[model samples]
Target chain A: MSTMTMAKALNAGLRRALDANPKVLLFGEDIGKLGGVFRITEGLQKDFGEERVIDAPLAESGIIGTSFGMAMRGYRPVIEIQFDGFVYPGFDQIVSQVAKFHNRTNGRSSVPMVVRIPYGGGIGAIEHHSESPEAYFVHTAGLKVVTCSNPNDAYWMIQQAVASDDPVIFLEPKRRYHDKGEVVHESKPIALHQARIVRGGTDATLIAYGPMVKTCVEAATIAEEEGRSLEVIDLRSLSPIDMVTLTHSVRRTRRAVVVHEDVRTLGVGAEVAARLGEELFYLMESPVLRVTGHDLPYPNSRVESDFLPDVDRILDAVDRSLAY
Target chain B: MSQPLQPWGGPPGATPHADAMTASDEMVQLLTPEGRRVEHPDFAFTGDDAEIAGLLREMVLARRLDLEGTSLQRQGELGLWPPLLGQEAAQIGSGRAVRDADMVFPTYREHGVAMLRGVPVGDMLALFRGTSMGDWDIDEHRFGQYQIIIGAQTLHATGYAMALQRDGLIGNPEPDRNAAVLVYHGDGASSQGDVNESYVFAASFQAPVVFFCMNNQWAISEPSTRQSRIPLYQRAWGYGFPGVRVDGNDVLAVKAVTDWAMERARQGQGPAFIEAFTYRMGAHTTSDDPTKYRLSEETEAWRRKDPIERVKTYLLDAGAIDDGWLSDLDAEADALGEHIRSTCRQLDSESLAHRFDVLFREPTAESEDDRDAHLSYLARFEPLSEESAR
Candidate 1:
């Protein structure tokens, strides 16, 4: 195991995927020489050559659309959409074509493609730069949407996403890209759509994903000082959400609070709450609560902290749920 | 009035069709707008009168289907409909020209092509209804799903063509039986990066594909003037292939062109780019109001060159059908319209619930759990009985 930032872990994961699969090709804007704006694809183009690590034109839709054709031609294309907000330009290709190609061909053709997007807010970026658009892809069927909170999961999840048979929307938490964690270099490969229990407890369950996963873990640590035991489940997959893990945790804790960096309205938390209420109705001490970002565009850098949920907000929700 | 604007890259005295109709060209338009048949001498249409009538009937049906779809949109049964009102000649002609084995990649507005491929009209409406993604199997129909993203289909068609050729499927060396792909886009799509990249890949690999661009004058509110400064058809010559412009409203001309192109492709010749000069009689979609940007005079001028009306006029002039037969055809069209209206209504309630099933062929364990939870929650209103559960 090695301690590394989320960016380095992702770089290592991509290197492992490229070394494992000869067919894996990386294509995106500025991903070649610049190693991407975030440097997540650092040193890939130099090692893999231009053919495999293509620096595509600045068209997001073209990158994804052509990658679909490439995947059909027996190439496993791992595309980077650059940013969460920019993914909309390729929304038509991602939703209409990439997602439906399997069922449209009656399973004769499958898109073994991965679209990596850096999502969520808190970096205080410009307009359309810091947005959580996972709900759009998650709502659309035929897409497998997943996200990683820390370096270890980011490293393994990207490789798992690339290996999946169905098209996977791998959303990286841009805000958490530099956060450090111990990453196991080689581990038993996990399923792409399953949730992992980052920290186990007994008082209540704090479910989160992407950037909020770390926040939830921090909230759990703070809650320990306040004599509240909170379990944190990192929901790795957003689309095919791991309800089994969620329900089991809720059953054990008898209370749950879902958290995310996206707007509270119709966020992934809603689905989690609705599902928990139905499956584990008798196993609850209180109504399922959520500590999420306000339903507004990510505010300016000065007020961004007020818009995003932090350790205090998450712990407050836990206290409320425990009091009930 | 002004030297006919000399196409894109033609010679000083070159006729529009002269430079376009090369033997190696995939865009071999045979008929000129003056209703004159000009063959390539090397390639000819050998079909008899009966075959011509069948082709005309297909075009007529395609027009009827398009009209029916537009009407369905007006009735609020569809989320949107990109009307193929004036491009029937281009779609029908090219659709009929392709062999059964050849694959076709279509943009959103290829209703005529879908009809030719035998996709049920109800299935096509499902896309607009937002009830289903696409209803037909791409392999079985040999027609790709309607791609809403502009110019993306060109790459798919190119890749498929490459696969077919690489497999040595070009049977019988005497009259090469290689499969070809026809990818349809619009003049507006010509400005897209993917379309140009598709041209590069097709040229580089010598893929057996045809890039069919229907230059229908307008893309929503933007005119062809904004899309290109020159005729889009002639742009193909720079890409190492011939490009032709045909009066897309003329069904005969479009059929002649597409047929010749498909034959060249089957004979192992490379890709072709065709520019079908047509007009859009309606708005870009149901939400669009054409009156906001377009002039009434322009619409009226294009109406005179209506694809269906021109074919109807020529059929009557050639004594191909009498007034009674025309009336019977109108009645058939009316029946199709009625069927579409009723089918659309029936689909509203039935198609709304299948959104989950189409999400994944094999739903992940989590998705299965989600669906189960949703069903149980909905069951509270009317609990499921043993029979209902089964």
Candidate 2:
């Protein structure tokens, strides 16, 4: 076991992927010698030559479209969209070609590529930087969306996404990039798309993914001091969704709350709420409440903490659900 | 009044065409509009009578398919069709220059190129007919699937060419073995950022690809003049690659220019660009009306310079084909058009209900549930009444 940050774990995982496949290519802006803005791809270009670790032009669509072509020629390419908002420039290539290639060719061709985006807010950034753009990718039919909260999950999930035959939108939590944790490489890695139960409790269930997993875990810990039990479930896979684990937890607690930093309307939380309503109709003691960001755009960093859900807001929602 | 700006590479006394192109900077030509054989400084067409006749046959068939596709849309057999009427030479010339080993990335309007790449006429119509968005086996044809977004395929072609070069295929000793990529787009699509970025990557990586832009003068209602300040081909010179402008109405000229560019790319000379100066003779698609934006005089001028008329004229003037051979080609085009009409009309929609089945290699639980829910909801509807069936 080694102690590392999420950024370091992700870099290690990317290096392993490059080593495993000779045809794999990594392309990103400022990712070669600069090693990405967060240093997530540091030392990779040195280890792997510039030919394998390419420093692409300042065009996102070119990176993805060319990656799509390379994938057609039997090369697996991992692309990095500098930030969450930056991915919009490449959205056409992603939704139109990268996401649709396998379905467009009826399984005859596979685009085994990873589009890594550092998402979510907390770094006191400018507009277009601290955006949660997961819903756009999750709504896309052909793409498999996933995110990791800790270093261990980051290491395994990065490798798993690169290894999968499907094109994966691998979202990294920018705020949690520096959070340190243990990564036991020898331990059995979890499935890329399965949700994991972070904490076991019976009073109520807390559902979250990516950065919110840590918030939900914190909420559960604080709630225990007040004689309340909350089960925290980390939904690693947002698209396929671990319905089995979700139903098990919700059915046991009979009350639930979903948390995320994205907007409440049409966000990942809304989808989870709908699924809970469909699967656990009469079993629920109260409606599934959501502790999430406001429907408005992510506010400026000055008021972002207020706009984003925190431990207090989650506990407040949990209290309301228990009251119902 | 200020003097005209000389073309970037033309000589001092050369008269420029449309901001920058001289007579010396003019494209390669074999069969002129006057049915005369001409020579070009960069390329030549040395094909014999049999090869010329074959090329003529392809042009005839492609024109027939294009006309029939528009006819199908007018007859309500298709939702839409983008007619490739006046750009036959631009497509066939570039399409034929490609070897089977090379890859092609085509825009949605490259019906002629798709036909030459061995994709069936029926499959080409699938997208407009509302059946599929092109599910052809790309490996078998060495062609990228049809891309609807304008100019996006150029990036794919550049990347594919880069991979081909990296694999030691370019400049290989094996005869007809080296591969290159040819990407097709229209003048309107040239304004897209992806297209310009493609040039950067192709130049930086020295990818073996040809950027074939059919400058058909109109991007729907917008003219090519509105899209660029200089001639379309002259823009590539800024991107550090060789670029040329060809007479799109001259089939022999287009073929020669494209052939030279492909050969250059295969020889590890990096990427090349060809801007085919042509006109969009028909409406952009079934939904558009060219009369709203274009003038009859402009269309008439291009009609007088029709690519097919010049080829047919040259063939007959040279006694390369007889009256009987011309009649045979007409009959064959008629037969092929009839088959296309019949096949499109008889397209069955029963299989469309299962389109979600092939959406993924293994259907996710959410998608599977979505499919099941939709199918069951469809079961609630009553069968069509006799009067409403039509």
Top DockQ prediction, candidate number: 2
Q: Model 2: per-residue lDDT, tens digit, A201-307?
A: 99999999999999999989999999999999999999778898999999999998999999988988899999899989999999999998899988889999999
Maximum-TM-score candidate: 2
Interface RMSD per candidate (angstroms): 3.7, 1.6
Candidate 2 has which clashing residue pairs, if any? Answer: none
lDDT of each: 0.80, 0.88
Q: Give one digit per residue, the lDDT tens place, for model 1 in A14-130.
A: 999999997888989899999998999999999998767878767777677767766775678899888888988788788878888876654566878999999888887887778
Model 1: pairs clashing at backbone N, Cα or C within 3 Å = none
Residue-level lDDT of model 2, residues B143-222, one tens digit each, is: 78888888889988988997897678898777487989999988988899999989999989889999999899999999
Residue B5 local lDDT, model 2: 51
DockQ (0 to 1) for model 2: 0.68
Q: Which stretches of candidate 2 lie over 4 Å from their true place?
A: B1-6, B9-24, B350-353, B379-390
Error of 1 at B37 (Å): 2.8
Which candidate number would show the highest lDDT if scored against the true structure? 2
TM-score against truth, every candidate: 0.72, 0.94
